[model samples]
Target: MQSTSHSAVLGRRKEPHTIIIARGDAVRHFTIRPWVATLLVCCVAVIAAGYLLATTYLVLRDDLIGASVAWQARMQQAYEDRIATLRSQIDRITSRQLLDQQLMEQKVNELIERQTALTERQNVIAPIVERVNTAPTGEESERIEKKPQLGTVSPDQSGFKASQIAALWKTRTESLNKTPAEKADLAFSTITKSLRHVEDDQLKRLESLADDAYQTADKISQALASAGLVIDVDYDKANVGGPLIEIDKSQVFDTRVRELNAAFRMLDTVKDQARSLPVANPAPGRPVSSSFGVRRDPIIGTAALHSGMDFRTGTGTPIRATASGTVVSAGWSGGYGRMVEVEHGQGFTTRYAHMSEILVVPGEKIERGMIVGKTGSSGRSTGPHLHYEVRKNGTALDPLRFITAGRQIQSYL
Candidate 1:
């Protein structure tokens, strides 16, 4: 009987547990396995952790956004405060020692504006001056380099010669015992005169640079024309129209700068065109076996029109493209075996003939000095050589003109 009672107790322990909810005369029961209860607790813990992580992410995001906005506002305010301080300094320098303070303020402000404009002009002129100093057109840059004043000063230091002017004015005005108004006017007059001298010097230097640029452009234009090609110097202009107003004499420096900039643009266009010309030798250090013109045919022994120059080279010597262009034709042709023809724009084309091996194919882009083929006498019976030709608008041109121009450009480059 005792054993039977012990077995009943063990069976109760193995069965699932019941969770009971009790109220006055009302009761409910929920049966669950121990493993199910454990799973429920774990799910509640996971949800609570997720909620905390999401809340943290939202709080941190708000903080970061607020910080970014505050940073921008701070920077903007700093810039405004700095600008205000500079204006206040200008006012203190102008209105501190004059009876007619209002009138002197206006005049001094105008002079300050002029000085500021001159200072900005100095920054613009600096690069142009440096370019002139370094430009390959030899002696002009040499002379400019010798002039110590042409080198650029710091932007703030340019045309702000207040201390020097103040000292000189104090000496001259102290003896006369000038009135405050007169003293202020005289001081401003001296500043204006000083700024004018600097502006005039800058204008003269720019004029000199513009003249030199135009001269270089002119020489390049002439050289190109000799090869029967003309470069269009007038690049496209931007759309611009405005109501005309009376010109201000104060704007003379700016107006001249605009004109000089326009001249430099033309010079740049000319230089680009010059670069595209066939101005490089196909086989450097090679002797010309035959010149372009009527020449005695090697096999037939009769005068024939030779449309190109022939450079004497050994078999398999490298032959390079004279200018950057696209290969218009390549491969074997009658009388000119294994030829590569390149079309450089502006109606100019170049041909390499008698090549034993063509390294480029039709429609391939080639850059200047790229090896296009190997030189060999493959057609019309001759020793190993490279036959090079320059043509414009389908008419053969003398290659010597281009070769000579190349030499001239090299001298400067």
Candidate 2:
């Protein structure tokens, strides 16, 4: 706390100061007060430091600016690289989505084609099914109907949409939170499985249809055999022609088609033969007076050799021919009055004896059931009756046999 004067302190610092400079051949000396010398030295030191600092700033300005610009460029490049990586990921996802869409569309198209083919097959087989059902009920009909049911799908149900499938896939993927590629792969697998199921069902239906066709053909063959006719069919004969490319290449289907063809051909041949064969009763709804065999003749009253059957009828009753044939003889004969004879094909012939009047002449064409004469007891008969005889190559046969055959075949025809 001692008080000191400002002038006294200032007076004490005013002390003498000295400086000297020497060159090679010259020497110089200078003297000054202590306060002045200190002020001068401080001023000179401040100016030198300022100049040095200004020179250093000038020298480093370009380098600092370049470094700042390079740092900014590096930051921008890093950002660009991040953006490119994100873009590549997006591209991959987009490509996978497109591929999945294409595959789904292809599966849908395949399902549609299979459905169309099944519909066509049904159409072709419907008529045959109806025909088989119309036959007489028995074991054969039961066998034909006892087949596996075919699985059917409507057009609307079979036409699966890509958008709908995609929606379903998206829903599942969202629930599982799977990656885009994983979702696409799972969706494709599901679609493929569904298509395979549909195709398998169609194939099974086709196989069933083929089996039904084969069964029908077999029945037809048996029916033809019952008619006493043989059908010789060439299975290798090609009745159908088309391009080499076939839509259906199944061996089972091909075999069934061939069987059906042969069966139909056999039926046609049997029908032709039935038309020409002699299988009609000459006297319908009439009682037989005598059977075809050795019997006592009423006129001779003895066990005479009887070669024909006789039907009891009133005089002038219509007599019809038993089969289609050409007239071989007509007019009167010794024991048979107003007799007529017909020569049918296949070594078959028929005779009508003891008729009231002969309506056919020699070499005249006649059909089965045609009115050929009138029934009467003529030369050697005691009562009104008809005499009918069937012969094969000039040998006598029982007329009753032919009539029985006609009765048996009537239902089938």
Candidate 3:
């Protein structure tokens, strides 16, 4: 009996528990031991915890993705802004470079214009200078030539120098700064200064030339005065008026040009007057036999006033008028046979007497060196000789003096 009771207790302890449920007219039953039930509860807890962990992992992954996308967008925007700023800077630099180029072009054009003006002025003045250098003033010719040593700076050379300076300035400006505006300003300033210097040099050269011309004209005037000739210039009637225009700021150049013109005009007037003077030799290459003044008369053999010079020439030798004039007498006169008288203007007259024949008529115009008569001893002479007389307002004067003055003036011409 005791063995039987212990077996039953062991069986009961190992026996599986049974559970039943009934709902909605359906019934179900399940039986499990303590170890199986514990396993089932553990499985349900593990499955629930897996579901919660999966949900949390999905939410966290989406949040991390959003944050990463937003960070990437910010980085892209920053890069674009940086690029735009760089482009703006480049544009500003380009515009400045263009402006600098334009300014350089303008400066070059101005330099060209100045060179042209200077060249024109030089051309106009060169001939006047040459005339001055060539003028002859008897003993003073040598001194006048040596008076003014005019040194001229060629306009071409000046322009070339200016170009060189501009090139050097450009090179230096380029080296100074990276900014285009600064470089342009520096170049402009340098060119302006160089141009001013060139202008000053040109002005000085022109003024010197003008001074030389004035001096030459003055010397010529003095020579004329010494020869008893005067140039009558009417300043009030010069007709120099003109409409007022913009005066050149370079006054020196304009003033020099005007002075040169005036000097040249004066020289021309003097030359013309000298040409019209009755001072030519009447008998060229002929020896004088008798001088004018109180001398022994060849015919009378007595001291008497020899009012004319005598040239010993054979008959039929050509006699020429000493000056251009109108013939007033072309026939024989008392003590003169076949005589010809010419009335030159300016209170001057010439007479040729003792001629073989008269080739000119009374009231006829005669030119200098024209055939007026032939040389012969027709009246008041002892042999074949010709008499020439020069008178100033009907007063007899020495023809030799007038001939000498003519020679001197001719040298200048």
Candidate 4:
């Protein structure tokens, strides 16, 4: 049965089909085998499948390419954005660092200028302080135990020297994670504060010195008034001028200095006046035989006005000039025989009367304590004595007033 089925399949496959076609009187015949037909069908099917597959590929190619291009663009944009962000961050950091540096430099420069200004102020204040320290203060002299050495700012006191600031900066930078500019800024601020303190100290010193000078001048004035001598001091206007600059009231150092200088000038003027006044006793360590006023006349034995104080001393005792002056009259003058009159300036004069001998001639310049004559009872007197008279502009004044004032003012001088 298998052989029969196989023979049948083979016979069908070997069978040929014939087709005849006639056009007009001519005819044509064609024969086709089953195997050939099957082969042709296979070739047609293969060609159709290949065409369909090619068409499908052509339809999807554009979408695939578009997706791939989109993905690549996204990746490139992401990379670019990341790079831009990093660049911005780096720029910000760099800019911040530069700004910090500039600020630090500005602060440091300001500190340096302030320090220089303080140094200049010290220069002006040093001499003024020295003058105040050396000035006579009478009983208060003990209070001024020592004079400070000026013109140098102690770093330990102020804590603002350049080297110290640098050291501080280094120490802070090592301890902190801060940048160099930040550390520098901190150091500069510290220095500025210290310099401000120094400035304040200088101002205070100047103020104190100025007050002392003015007080000294006032004391001299008061002392002169006590002696019944009112002296006027005129201070010359200082030739000071400068370019206009805005200054606050707190910065009055220059004003203080000017005031101190004026005080010194006034003190000098008063001192000169005091020196010219007759204030010393002509015969020191001698007893006063007769007081200045109405007294009994030794020779006449009656009450009379005694124009001067009489000092009892042996004849030929040395008599000294009470003040520096010129010998205006050194010759005999009737009752004031062998008299020596000294003309001290400021309308003051001294007369040494009843002298046994005149040591200075008229028109001779003499200083205080100079031996101007010898004591004797040469003018309407009955004993060896010296008559000392203090006159102001030809008018007699109490000699005791000047003598007392001199004693009080001696310490100041």
TM-score to true structure, per model: 0.60, 0.53, 0.62, 0.62
RMSD of each: 34.8, 10.4, 9.0, 9.7
TM-score of predicted model 3?
A: 0.62
TM-score sort, best first = 4, 3, 1, 2
lDDT (10s digit) by residue, model 4, range 331-401: 89999888999999878899999999999999999987899989998877788899899998898887777
Sort every candidate by lDDT, greatest first.
Answer: 1, 4, 3, 2
- lDDT of each structure? 0.80, 0.70, 0.73, 0.78
lDDT of 3 by residue, 1-413 (tens): 98789888776446688888888889888898898999999999999999889888897988888889989989988998899999998888788668767777777788778767767766765675576566556644665454442334355645557549988778877667656556666666766666666567656655655555455455555565665656564442476788878766866677866766775576567655655556677788889998889997766679899888888889899998877889999988878877999998888788999998889999998887899988887876678778999887898888776677667666555
Best by TM-score: 4
lDDT of 3: 0.73
lDDT string for model 1 (1-413, tens) is 98789888776447788989999789998999999999999999999999898888887988889899999999999999999999998887766645377777788788889878877887888776666555555654565655434323434435557667887667796837987667777788877876776777677667766676677777777766676657665453456668989778777677767867877887877776776789889999999988999989888889999898999989999999988899999999878888999999979999999899999999999988899999988876468899899998999988988888876664333
Best by lDDT: 1
Report the C-alpha displacement of residue 165, candidate 1, in angstroms: 18
Residues 41-150, candidate 2: write the lDDT tens digits: 99999999998988888998788889989999999999999989899989987887787778757756765675576566556555655555567344445654564333
- After superposing candidate 2, which stretches have Cα over 4 Å from the reference? 1-251, 315-320, 330-334, 356-374
Question: How many clashes does the backbone of model 4 have?
Answer: 0
